[model samples]
Target: MRQLLAPALLVAGLLLSGCAGFQPLYAQPGVTRDLGAIEVTAPAGRTGYLMRQHLDDAFAKNHSVAPRYTMDLALAEARYPRGVRIDNVATRYEYVLTVTYVLKDLPSGAVARRGRVRVELTYDSADQPYASISAQQDAQDRATDEAARRIELELAAWLGTTAKVAAK
Candidate 1:
């Protein structure tokens, strides 16, 4: 039984390894360059500011080079109270951020892609006012980071596939 189990496990491992062709998206040819060439334009507000900063970091935009693509972003944020106390005070809150974006080719001025991403987070409302404010700010930061990551992934995937198609 031991000999049979070892052989079966080895075979399974080899088969599974062959099935996986996983490759990092940014590592693909042209994908990283394309990401670095994108410029983001976000709406006016704190949430928009956060999203723009996060997106710039994720895209690794280069200041020296002119952007090849422009991404226009519209952001909306909403907060809802949850876990209400007996006195009608809220013990927890949910933060929801929704972003809609359009990617356009700079020279051609043509829309390349359009997508939306939503991020939701929950935070506890502390008794202290400052602590509660701090917690809410932290939640907003986390949500913005998450939204930026999602946008990066979506753009990378699109760029990777488009590069492949263009190559062929």
Candidate 2:
């Protein structure tokens, strides 16, 4: 049984290896460099600041360098009460963050790409006031991080494919 299992596993691995069209985005030649060349505009308010910080880290943008592309972002947030108690209290809440972004080519001022991302998170509301506030803050942080990650991935994939096409 063991001998047969080993051969079967080997065959499966070999078959899967033959499939194409799967490549790491960052491993592509110019993707990382392109991401680093972008400048993200500073956003407004506390939540916006968190989102912008995450994006800056993801893009690896250097403070000293002039950006080749400028990215402008707009953020909106909403909260909804859920799992309501009988006494007109809510036990849980849902937080939603929506971010829209535009990427522009610096030299020509042409809009290169535009997209939006939405993230949702849920958290329990504690009995204590401070605890409830803390929980809500944590949810916001999680949602902001997720939104930033999605935006980074979208931008990287766009840069990878567009760079390849432009090079051709």
Candidate 3:
């Protein structure tokens, strides 16, 4: 009975300690509001357009109110042939999309945060031209969506920590 009780108490103590100082990042006050206030500017092209759409959705921007911060993104895209056949024809391709972003405070015109997010995707190359193009477009969409998600997470974390620091 003593041995069993000791292990149970240890487990309970460990569980209680784990919850002592744990705070959910997104639950911090004003994180969602801060995110919604950012305006995103992306380059001009299909990839840029897709990225902008994703970011706008993620931020839930409200155009009626003035923005507190602006984010500028520089996007680069590249594609490489991954697998080649005996006759030097490509069978698979790799697509890489990278975006470097700078977040600036609109009020003070100072840079608040800078980050880069990159995503790589692979798609099979088809003999039909239309099919190949469709596959590449699908990859581009996926890469842009993933990059947007990562950027949103990073920005939320940064905003959360900044709020904490300011509070202290």
Question: Model 1, 1-168: lDDT tens per residue?
Answer: 998999999999999898798777776789989899999998888778999999999998888889999999988889999999999999999999999999999999899999999999899999999999999999988999999999999999999999888889
Instruction: Arrange candidates, best TM-score first.
Output: 2, 1, 3
Better of 1 and 2 by lDDT: 1
lDDT of each residue in 81-111, candidate 2, tens digit only? 9999999899999999999999999889899
Off by over 4 Å in 2: 1-9
Measured against the true structure, the TM-scores of the candidates, in listed sequence, are 0.89, 0.89, 0.88
Mark the 10 consecutive residues where model 1 has the least summed lDDT: 19-28
Residue 18, model 3: lDDT of 87
Q: What lDDT would each prediction earn against the true structure?
A: 0.93, 0.88, 0.93
lDDT of 1 at 97: 92
- Cα deviation at 85, candidate 3, in Å, is 1.1
**Whose lDDT is higher: candidate 2's or candidate 3's?**
3
Candidate 1 residue 124 Cα shift, in angstroms, is 0.7
